[model samples]
Target: MKHLFLTALLAVAMPAWADAVDTLKRFVQEVRSGQAAFTQTVTSPDGAKKRVTQGRFEFARPGRFRFEYDKPFEQLIVADGQKVWLYDPDLHQVTVRAMDQALGATPAALLAGGSLEKDFRLAPAEASDGLQWVEAVPRDKDSQFRTVRVGFRDQALAALEILDNFGQKSVLQFSQVQSNVAVPAERFRFTPPAGADVLEQ
Candidate 1:
């Protein structure tokens, strides 16, 4: 009787594991655009130091997004399909890189739409903190991130936990998520302020 009960338990638990990866696939395929407020906490490799930042993000499919950091510092990152622009208001500088060179195998690529199976080795991760998790290991050997875990709550994107090559961990918790909304086209456009230094890579 005990063996039979164990088998039944295993059958029930197995589907939950697949749910995480399935949720991610559905999210990537169905949600074309989204905007959300996020809190990002980054921890040092030794866990002795930490930094927190708050931001608002908006993204459209096929390579367009904007991340505007508001607290602690004012910075903006915009991907305009062709180039990725990083602007530092305090430093009065703008940096630009080709989008293809900047986003390959990164979290932005995952969320901004791509060939997921080609870029990542996807697997179901153990559920934690009341969220189902999917772990994505980038197939690009030269990628900066070691692993990226996306967490979903009730089939909605809840959080992203990224572990980098240097052992640093960054966790982004999203709130006020609005999925499949029409984001303004201007959100992905960036222009350097007059007199600000611009560097292109």
Candidate 2:
């Protein structure tokens, strides 16, 4: 009976792992070709939810992406397939950092060239309310976010929950994700607003 249980566990896990890898690869491939728009609703740890943020997310090969947020706050975050730029119009400040360095705590890194199996290990997760879950833990203890939990529906990423090092949790639920759409090259370009203070991270 113990052996049967173990076999059953492995049976579930192995297929899930393969599915994750394949899903990631397909997602990345589509993203690299500049396809996919992500809309997310962010909820505070206290359960208070903010207005939904809608954006057309575009990705290019090697590590480039643009997340354009429209609603409540208009902000642009772009990683030039290399360095990352986070510009906040409200604060009038732009933060720049190495793309690879910033992927430590976020799930975006999973698609940005960081190998999930290498940097973190994953396991088959639970399903509730029709959402399938996958949990990933960083191999490096010093990493910012302790764990990343991704929820999928029909192989599409439905949500992501991030648990940061400071114990702060941010939950983002996605909707209307369109894959394989053509995204323009200009979407990723950034010219800091006239007086915005640019800070390097």
Q: Number of the top candidate by TM-score?
A: 1
Question: Which residue window of length 10 is worst by lDDT in model 2?
Answer: 1-10
Clashing pairs in 2: 63-81, 64-81
Instruction: Give the number of the best model, judged by lDDT.
Output: 1
For all predictions, the C-alpha RMSD in Å is 5.8, 5.2
For candidate 1, the per-residue lDDT at 14 reads 74
Tens-place lDDT digits, model 2, residues 10-48: 657665544544555465455554444555655555666
What's each prediction's TM-score? 0.93, 0.78
Worst 10 residues of 1 by lDDT: 1-10
lDDT, model 2: 0.65
- Tell me which residue pairs clash in candidate 1: none
The local distance difference test score of model 1 is 0.87
| TM-score, cand. 1 vs. native | 0.93
